[model samples]
Target: MSAPTLAPYVFKRPWLRNLLNPLANWYANAAGYRKLGLRADDLISEENAVVAQALKRLPMKENYDRVFRLRRAMQCSITHKLLPKSEWTKPEEDVPYLGPLIAEIEAEAKERAQLDTLTVVKNH
Candidate 1:
């Protein structure tokens, strides 16, 4: 499950977004995933049921791409080298490919839980 976040609140305030944007960018760059040719979503652990489901639900091409990125990252890690700058994942290319799927799965689970506990009343 995703951690609770103040992202919505932070995003709603222009000043806050402006203030944090640079720091966020700097942190992302410093995280080194992009240097290894991996997107932010690639760093999400698959140990969670939600993430695992999301991964399984990924489109075939996207799944293939995710696998390729992961393997490439692993190889780079093993070799103790980063991808060339030209091939490093650009900030714009680091979108959350698996996040929406995970959200959808979580929503479905919530709905199912609600439905499972729903009570029906008899009408006179």
Candidate 2:
């Protein structure tokens, strides 16, 4: 499950978004995934069932790309080296490819749960 956050609230406030944008970028850069050519979504842990399901739902090309990024990142980690600067994941390229899938899976699960417990009443 994703951590609870004020992201929605912050995003709705232009001033807050503007204030945090630079810091968020700085933090993302400092996190070092981009240095290894990994996107932000690639950092999400896949140990949970929801994430696993989401991964399975990815399109063929997207799944292949995810695996490629992961393997490349792992190789970089093993070698204790970063990818060349040119190959570092640019901010624009670091989109949340898996996040939407995860959200969809979660929404489906929630809807299923609600339906499972649904009750019907009939009038005479």
Candidate 3:
């Protein structure tokens, strides 16, 4: 990917960044594991569980990480067997992609909880 087109796509809304960061981080870490010559497919169970929990809380139809991975895998298999490359644009798939957003919200909630604890401590 060249810098020109990539840079434009890089600087989007902060809220989206906050939302996608966890999935992005998860992808990055998985890639890092691959770089270290480890197959991370066996590690998907834990991520799958988190993705499942997140989906219940998401109140939306799509979960990017969960759905996208499945789409990519299916596409890979199909293209290699039945489909043509010209016909498969990786299917433009996405999963709930909400893990990062939830983490951020949860962290903020935890901080507020701690602040309330301190306030109670001061009252005592």
Query: What lDDT does the true structure give each of the candidates?
Result: 0.92, 0.92, 0.46
User: Can you tell me which runs of candidate 2 are displaced by over 4 Å?
Assistant: none
Off by over 4 Å in 1: none
Candidate 1 per-residue lDDT over residues 31-90, each given as its tens digit: 999998999999889999889889889999999999999999999999998899999998
Clashing pairs for predicted structure model 2, backbone only = none
- Candidate 3 local lDDT, 4-120, one digit each (tens): 344235457677677777787577544533222223332244345443454566544544444554555566556664334443322123222464544655666688989888843
Per-prediction backbone clash count: 0, 0, 6
- Sort the predicted structures by TM-score, highest score first: 1, 2, 3
RMSD to the hidden true structure, all candidates: 1.0, 1.1, 10.9
Q: Pick the candidate with the highest lDDT.
A: 1
* Alpha-carbon TM-score of each model against the true structure: 0.95, 0.94, 0.33
Error of 3 at 62 (Å): 1.0
Q: Superposing every Cα of model 2 onto the true structure, what RMSD results? A: 1.1
lDDT of 2: 0.92
Collision pairs in model 3:
63-95, 63-96, 64-94, 64-95, 64-96, 64-97
